[model samples]
Target chain A: MPATRYRAAPAATLSIVSLDLMRAVYHRASGRTHLVSEPVPEILAALADEPLDEVALLDRLARDYAIEGDAAALGERLEELVATGLVEQL
Target chain B: MNHVFAVRIGPVGFRVGSDWRAPIDTLADLYRDYPAPEDGIPDFSVRLFARRPWRRVLRPQVMIGGDYTIPDAAPLPLSLGLLAAEMGMNLQMALAQRRYLLLHASCIERDGRAILMTGESGAGKSTLAALMMARGWRLMGDEFALVEPETGLIYSFPRLVSLKNQSVGVVGEALRGARFGPWQRDTPKGDIRHLVPDGASIAAMAEPARAAAILFPAYGHAPDRREVAPGECFVRLTQASTNYVALGERGFDTLTRLVRDVPATAIDYPDAATACAMVEEFAA
Candidate 1:
């Protein structure tokens, strides 16, 4: 069986503003400001340019960051982004 | 509605109508320093009237009504009519102000720099601002700080300062010639008094200055000060704003610009002097 693919929503726009110790995402479409940190923003940056399936997204992330992560866990994070309407299943 | 008075406070104008003439007189005397709208049109209307037809003559409960009012809001006795009028004006601004990003914060200015202070209720923002006015800084606003989205400039909304509980006496000594409205005991916010801001705020109400610093103040604590990171400041400001959600993308741009452009810090103090000194030092 093949896993479902995901991509960034057309209307969703993200602006990552950095502070001393934290980063925030301004979701233009949702009108919601979110506080994010570390690897999450890195994950968001990975997903922001283009969408990828669970395995492909993790592979993409692994190339840039030394993340010893699992596909299932990475997939869960993608689902959270999906819940926030930042990305959707292709 | 017997008496109707139109006055402009800062960028917004209000036409307050009351069933009794007393509230109007009190408003006029307290707001004597404020200028009236030039064209005679108000951005919002505050109406203080009795709900039931005979309630005016019976219990004399005055219900505060305005451009936007809660249907089930309880009434205050006639003695608190001034309180009702002021609350009505604040309600209108909170619910209807849209030209700028409105924050539930106090603002003071010196030498073209504006310092914005916001926090939860009883954070001593009002008390601190009133004290600053008594010193030398111009009180830009006591309740709502209006920030222009394009320029990131803070405008003056120097309405009457609402001093609650013991802060009333604290402010009483600071005011030089300004007199507070009659003290009313046992309101929702404990003993309350309304202090009119100094004439400088009124004279410079039309002026706008750059936002230089943002401070989140907490009262009744040992003196402590810490820098708030951009993310923390952004979230706190969104919570502080009265119309952030309504302003949408404009609000996002403005608030992001504010945190990026202006420095933010949180200060905790047990007394007004320490708080003032901390802010002055930060501003310096």
Candidate 2:
């Protein structure tokens, strides 16, 4: 699993916002909120610190989410997250 | 006979009258006219109290009876005043059974789905909601729509769409041949109530819509339509909801699910006509 980074801001300074059900926790420290609902922990672990392509990301998410059996389920969830602005292709 | 309904909302209760009742009945019809995509049982119920000969039931916290006259005090926020003066005994009664949620909004239906027009007073959401109704959209309610939680559905309770001072002309002239109540002058909120649509279509509360779309209508001199990302819409709509806070965890989950499935947008229009067109275009 890749190193998991947890960011927090002191007090109620952190503002939380959602787009299309994508939850983002904003850090008053940097004014940029991390996408908390993207299953960051799961995806990072599946990626294993390696720079793989989009297909690799999908594979990791699907495997972690157990989408091998459901097939379309993992892909659909990812598309929804993308629509919510939580995940973006580099 | 006290011509008032004592309505208890959460912890607050008020005496309301027929001016409020008539609209609620109208809303029921509107709901029936355009049944929700998934037809469901109506939540509105009527109860008879033998001891109180003239009383009518509106909601759990509210009962309709007697006569109510607009207070002589300065008009409050026209929308708030309308809510405070609701005649629909079943309005709040219906609220208690479902999730007790209330919003200052105007609702209209297109393609059998209800799209809520909500914002703070003076945001022109009412005018926009009313204009949409004039253009064939069914009226829900001018001031509020009670949303049922489990289904994320809306219950219609039609009432007069309020038009304060300058808005009277802006809306009245645009929807030409509109019917309006006499304008009361010098109220706290200033004279109001330009027109009450022929809200006859309001019969039953709509089977709650799945919130197919959310648009923050911005009326500007220059017309523009801003396609809002769902994330922004989710943030705004959740905040705008009547029971967003009260619904607690369940409410949060329900809202998240609804926004996920709906397309949210921010619309700008120069006038009522344009606004109506935008709603139709989007709903289609």
Candidate 3:
């Protein structure tokens, strides 16, 4: 499987922490240690050592997650995650 | 007139009172909708009295009140809404007592095993629970579930799945015979409240079953995608738990006891129907 791309979005700090609370425990038990949440295992794998911007994040995920066929679909997913405090706008 | 009512969230007793009567009715209605355990008489207790200056206190055991007067023994003075919020917090505390812990999430059960789903308010937790219930998963509890500490058994509470704002229609479409109460306006959480079909054994829902898996559900802008990871699921579950602070020495034991024995996953989907299908299929 290819890497998953994660987008960091603007949201309340509490929302971010709440997601972190879930992501942190999930990562800890899996032994996937990191300074923060949002770069899920799949996301981490895709962009290893290479930082990608917002569009790149979506483009990479569209290809890797098999979420193809519509560029609009990619934009929507990025925006949705941004709303959910999962991804950020650059 | 001050309206005071007592209801139990899992093992804790929460009494909420305010100058207004609607909150009491709202809470009482919430409890009445889901019958209590015939065996356990809600040993964990707390009393919230509403006065001009509402106060809340959490003693070693319970929060007692004497009308508007704050007794010297009262631990904290709280707002009326704070008393209401205690319902969730008390549930969290009670779950920490046993091997089971409360997650800041929602859960639905099928075949006696729980599929835990969690997310922030708008992340679609309630919507997912409602959809799964429509498709055949037993309504374990909405927004909160009580799991057995030692056995990872999820005790069913059969409570209403609270949907907020726009998600109400999303769930209604999925559930054919959904029932909803009148919408209350201008509350802290905004316009909300709806009731899914009452589970067949709601009155008998205290029966506990092992928690088979935990799924962190996320609704994507797209509608058909599904991702499943049993290993990562377990890891996320331990993180969603609310009692990690209270479980202490027993935290590791309790968490490992549950996660190591069961599976966990992260569920990302586009719509309620697809989400429900994925949950039911996985539980099956």
Q: Score the docking of each candidate (DockQ).
A: 0.68, 0.16, 0.02
List runs of model 1 lying over 4 Å from the truth. none
lDDT tens per residue, model 2, B88-142: 3334333443353554456777666777666556667777777676667776766
In order of lDDT, best first, we have: 1, 3, 2
TM for candidate 1 is: 0.95
Candidate 1 DockQ score? 0.68
Best by TM-score: 1
Q: Which digits, one per residue and each the tens of the lDDT, describe model 1 over residues A1-90? A: 777878765534776678656776778878777776666777766766776777787887789876668987877777787898767777
Write one digit per residue (lDDT tens) for candidate 3, span B1-284: 25665554444334444444544565565457554433545444334433334322221222334222224533322322333334433443445344456666777776677777776667787777777777776677775666665655676545456677777777777666666655644446765655644645364466666677666677775544344443344456556666655554345445555655665566678766677777776676
lDDT of 3: 0.53
**lDDT by residue for model 1 (B1-284), tens:** 78998899998899999998888999999898788976888999999998787988888899999889988999998889889998999998888888999999999999999999999998999999999888899999889999998888899999889999888887887776777988877889888899988877889999998889999999889999899988889889989998998988888888888998898989999899899888888566
Question: Going through the candidates in order, what is the number of backbone clashes in each?
Answer: 0, 35, 22
> Quick one: best DockQ, which candidate?
1
Residue B77, candidate 2: Cα error in Å is 14
Each candidate's interface RMSD (Å, one decimal) is: 1.6, 7.4, 10.1
Off by over 4 Å in 3: A1-90, B8-14, B17-19, B36-41, B44-99, B176-179, B186-189, B221-235
